[model samples]
Target chain A: MAETGQILNLRRYRQLRNAVVVWLTLVVLGAFLLRIPRIHILEHTARNLYFHVPMWFTLMAAALVSAYHSLRYLQSGDPIRDLRAREAARVGIFFGLLGLATGIVWARFTWYLGTSLWWNFDPKQSFVVIQLLIYGAYFVLRSAVEDPEKRGRVAAVYNLFAVVTMPFLLYVLPRQMESLHPGAEGSPAFSDITHPIMRLVFYPAVIGFIGLFWVLYTQRVRLALLEQRVEMLQATMLEAKS
Target chain B: MKTWLRGFWAIFEKDIKLELRARYAINMLLLFALGALVVMAFAVGPTPLSARVQAALLWTVLLFAAAVGLGRAFISEEERGTILLLQLNLRPGAVYAGKLLVNFVLLLALNIVAVGAFAVLLRVQVAWPGLLALTLLLGSVGLAGATTLLSALIARAAGGRGALLPVLLFPVLVPLLLSAVEATRSALLVAEGWATAADELLTLTGFGGAVITAAVLLFDYIWLD
Candidate 1:
């Protein structure tokens, strides 16, 4: 059995976890405290740029990381790779949900303020929700397969298929539609409108949230590995008793 | 190469023969599609829907109709215990290609019937009938390519056979669905040449190509296991 310490550097995990915590603290503080030129209707809600957009960035990062692990799992047939892939997707879904929720709240107050419409089917947000549903289906698939090895291979295959569709949902289709989201057909690209100063906080917020995702994903992977080890030990003990 | 083609044809012929005899999936597909079209027509009443709305309705029906029938491609094999027989006999790529062809043909027939019913009942005057046909053909290819592999995966899954297919499939098919609807809308609404819908056509073709290539590459992993 590979040592858990070898599989994951505990000391590095602790260090990164702490760093993410502190980094995110500064990010949140900067998000609210920083001054920027505000446009009509957006006003202070523009601060959501720090929070809402980063969730998507983190989700994308998590997805890529998960797909990479799934590909590795297929190549090597490593159980640990499956665990890592599943954990990354779970955490990615968490961030995606956060992104969706924050988007609804942000939209309700800004664009749809008087209409009180929480979701008017903004193309970008709707597509993000669909992407999240794809992730949900991945979990459903994982649950349906019984054998661990078969489950791993089957789920990995599905995950790869799902991931390949993500780019189309996130980028291509949304671009084809009229969207309130920046960088859509009529709207200016993010680089054009976003103040240069916001990038300092925005970029870090994205990195920080992805760092947070990494911390959460690694922690779950460690727990899953331990659980697998315990199950193996129990099986051995049962055979011995027989 | 010869053996691969032979394997593909054998599976295709057997499936076609079985389907012709049983008519299980074909009946389900045609009935569901026509049913949905009638329901849509009655629900809309005499109101004249714009081309875009009509396109959306058509694809929605076709999508659900596919959900109803396309899964039988692999689920029937699993149910009949022919999966083992197939696993023993053919290459995984051949199996995937054969099933994909079956699904494409099935979906194409359903689309034609549904679209025919939709135009007749709803009084739709398609400006570009050829483009409409082209769009439906391309749409069927992409839908079949995407769903065939999914059908295989879902058949191996233990539970939720009925529910899992669409849940796993609909999201992945969104791009194809979007392009199909757009192209169909143009075909029905505009008198312009195919150049107007060239972008959507390219997207549909690319999506179909990419999905089939990926399915061919990955079907081995699912099939052997």
Candidate 2:
């Protein structure tokens, strides 16, 4: 606990955490209060774009952070970099699950209204589930290794591979298929189709969610560092006694 | 350069001789694939499943058989205590190439068996045998390369010998498998849909090339670790 600040730069973390709270508050307000033009079939449910889209953006941001740390781990062979990569992945997958749950709810009520179907095989949605499963295996792989340095090296390599697969799984392959979700020729890609008023909330929401991911990721890194220190201390005491 | 080729050949021949002696992994793969096809035939009951459904089923079975086939990529080395000695003697890249070649050869043969069963039992006809073979070739390259690396990674983990292979593999395989299924569908069933399938085949080739290239580059890290 005493050494945690040294590991995490506590002041900067606190500052960012505070800023994120206030920032997300304002984004939430804007999200609920902002007025926008409405259209058939989407109506008010279109507001979900702010919340749902940001989850994916945050997940991607977290993935990039994780992969960056993994690359550094491979280059430097640092355990701390391994810890950062692992925590960032854990947080990224959290955001991914949230995104999936939100998408299910949003789709069930909006496009799937009265269909009695909770999980229609939308290409993007199905592909995202696959993406999440890939990430899920990362943790399982982590759990299967006992040596700290070896685990770090192997998991870093695997993490690099996982992140490399992310773009193809999440976007490239799905786009090629006949999905009911737009992004095909007839529809302005979700980016071009949204309202200017919504952009006000959307941009901040993206930043805020990413900020939230950072705060959570940093928290995990600090805690894991503390745990590592305790293990070191215990190992030293046993060595001294022996 | 000569030594590198020699090292590669040694590993490739070792794996081939090992397999020939036991005839174990490939036999299990063929049996699993044939069993799955027979089960599907029973379940679907003679009236032909749609071409798309047939394609999906075939790819699914092939992917699973691949999982079982190459999941033992490094297990024999571990069991025989040769991994450390192999690492001492061979470049990791050469080791990767050999293992990948072994998987490629084994999976390519197993794939032919599975495809034959799909045609005979599932009553699916191949409209273009050459194109179907090409699609299988492309699909198996990615399959062999990826499973070889992943199996090696899993071999040293706390988990038993590649038990987690498919769990870690299937998601990453989706893109390759999807393209394989589509190309197979077009090559075997879809009249002149072959023209439209050019992009899918290209994607398959690129994906296979990228995975194999990356595996060769990165295998040293996990292997030596």
What is the number of backbone collisions in each predicted candidate, taken in the order shown? 0, 0
Candidates' chain A TM-scores: 0.92, 0.89
Give candidate 2 misplaced runs (Cα > 4 Å). Answer: A1-6, A170-172, A179-183, A238-242
| C-alpha lDDT (0 to 100) for residue A150 of candidate 2 | 81
lDDT of 2 by residue, B1-225 (tens): 888999999999999999999999889899999998899889988786777788899999999888877788788888888889998999998899999999999988888788888889988888878788888999899889889988988886654545688888888888888788888888777574668678778878888888887787668888885
DockQ of 2: 0.62
Q: Report residue B204 deviation for candidate 2 (angstroms).
A: 0.9
Per-residue accuracy of model 1 over A60-105 as CA lDDT, tens digit each? 8988999999999989897888998999999999999999999998
| Cα-based lDDT at residue A36, candidate 2 | 74
- DockQ of all models, two decimals each: 0.65, 0.62
Error of 2 at B82 (Å): 1.2
Candidate 1 error regions (>4 Å)? A1-3, A170-172, A237-242, B191-193
Q: What TM-score against the true fold does each predicted structure earn?
A: 0.94, 0.95
Question: What RMSD does each model have against the real structure?
Answer: 2.0, 2.2
